[model samples]
Target: MARHVLLAGIIGSTAYGLAGPGSDVDRIGVFAVDTVELHGLRAPRESYVTTRPDVTLHEAAKWCRLALGANPTATELAWLPPDLYETRTALGDDLVALRRAFLCAPRVRAAYLGYAARQLRTVERRLTGPGGANPRVAKAARHLARLVAQGRQLYRTGTVEIRLADPEPVRRFGERVAGGDLAAAYRLLAEAGDDLDRGRSPLPDRPDDEAVERWLRAVRAAHLAVA
Candidate 1:
């Protein structure tokens, strides 16, 4: 039978929503799959874990969900420098399949938005509370918060990721604010809704790109595997 294991990974500059000047260093990964295990479905499958204070299986599952949604960021994550991933008795094809469903952009954006909003509040409180206030520090603190708003849009609509404005588009817009600019930012982040739209536009043509190909391949493989 075949088996696979999660190894090191690099989320690197990937988590725009989680980023800050002194934000937590993002992570990347190395996963390994056994070819023999790939060939057999009845293999004892216990993966080896290097473990990190930062990475968790739940997050991995979350990534899978977002990727399945066709979220670009999540899709990009599954591909790290090959050196980081080491495959032995693992299911390479299976891992690819998981990434497909994991790329569910819509859901991932929602979850990431929540996380980013919370982080923004945490920083905001520290600066505005009585004995503290540094403009430069606060400016750096605001990046991820804004990105969260922007990312939410890109993820939902499948737009694109871009660096947000410095220091303050609008205060309290991080999580509490609803509608208007905040809402627009979220919509703009995931611009995929445009692609999925089959009306009033180019009437749906097939895409011919490596990223699209890889995603389709993974999803098809997964569906077949499941069936």
Candidate 2:
């Protein structure tokens, strides 16, 4: 069955206001296939993609499951700037409305810190190479700092702030990493990760699964009806 693109938005550096003149435009979206495909012998694929600037389209059901888990990347889509939308149907707007329902303290901690850890590993690997510093090292440092900031903000405010309103901390951390002061960078990441356990975070312990499921059902029903 043909795929139906439900929502598409700019993501990555451009969406986060970190893009430079040479940066590529990255996009992420959610799509759905005919209901029949879900029940047929061949299950629908979980995602679609295009090259060039890079676009990824997640199948609707898959997108929901990821969002329910509070996957950082998927959840950030809901908070994108109004101008970044390439496509947004009524159903897509409904999906965006449910973004906050997916926020769970544990999930945010895991996803954000986990991603930061992975990036740190990448930076560590790059540091061992012949060249003093690579572009990826700087990029990874920025992402790690951003993830930590976002996670800390989410816990404190119960909302994710994709574009850091105050980027000084991340900027300083990035500069340290870029200048080969990885020890300082690691310390900052550790401090940020530890903050997740401080006091009682404002975010909920788990997502509102019932509400999210109800919304998903409505979308599926509406699509099936049209199909």
Candidate 3:
């Protein structure tokens, strides 16, 4: 229950303002120890709060043949700022190997770009262009497109840097909605926009189409490499 609540909080708080012309990916994880292994001297490998940076949880996931290579969050956490987490156990070694396993050559770049393009096309035809009423949908679309750029950066550099910080971005997105800055508010009085459209998104008056396309290419290339 706690884990679910935490995940929801992260998503709900950041999902709105975190976008651009596309949506954003919200990644998270949870780990727990086993009860059967906790017999007398043998304790299940327990996760605990670590003395890290802005991150709050850091635990070494024990690497078993069945468990090691499939854990994406475990592998990703290893690359966070040193202050955020630390892992020197045998399991950590397996995770390092898994990173190499998930990466492909340059082909992943095309896949990510294709994925973002599909999304943009879908939104243009269905949501943002004609009769769509989702106030923040355009911003969400922008975020998704830019993420393609962030992903490409990851692939070329072999590093993942989180752009959407918590709380602030989300709140700003909501504030735009509260201010009635959506397409639906176009005809309302400037002062009346806030009262009439209480749940709108506040994207820029206009997002540059070229910027969205370019960002998608850069981000897509990088996302594939973040094992």
For each candidate in turn, the TM-score is: 0.39, 0.93, 0.36
1-227 per-residue lDDT for model 1 (tens digits) = 11223433445333433354664444433232333334675842332223444442222233344445544344444544444333322334445433433434434444455555554554556445665544433433444445454555444443433333432453344333221223433343334234323213221222223454454344334334331
- Specify the highest-TM-score model's number: 2
RMSD of each: 9.5, 1.8, 16.5
Candidate 1: worst-modelled 10 consecutive residues by lDDT = 198-207
What TM-score should be assigned to candidate 3?
Answer: 0.36
TM-score of 1: 0.39
- Who is ahead in lDDT, 1 or 2? 2
Tens digits of lDDT, candidate 3, 179-221: 4344322222222323323422222222233433343333233
Clash number for every model? 58, 0, 27
Q: Which regions of candidate 3 are displaced past 4 Å?
A: 1-27, 30-101, 128-130, 164-227
- Which ranges of candidate 2 are over 4 A from the true structure? 225-227
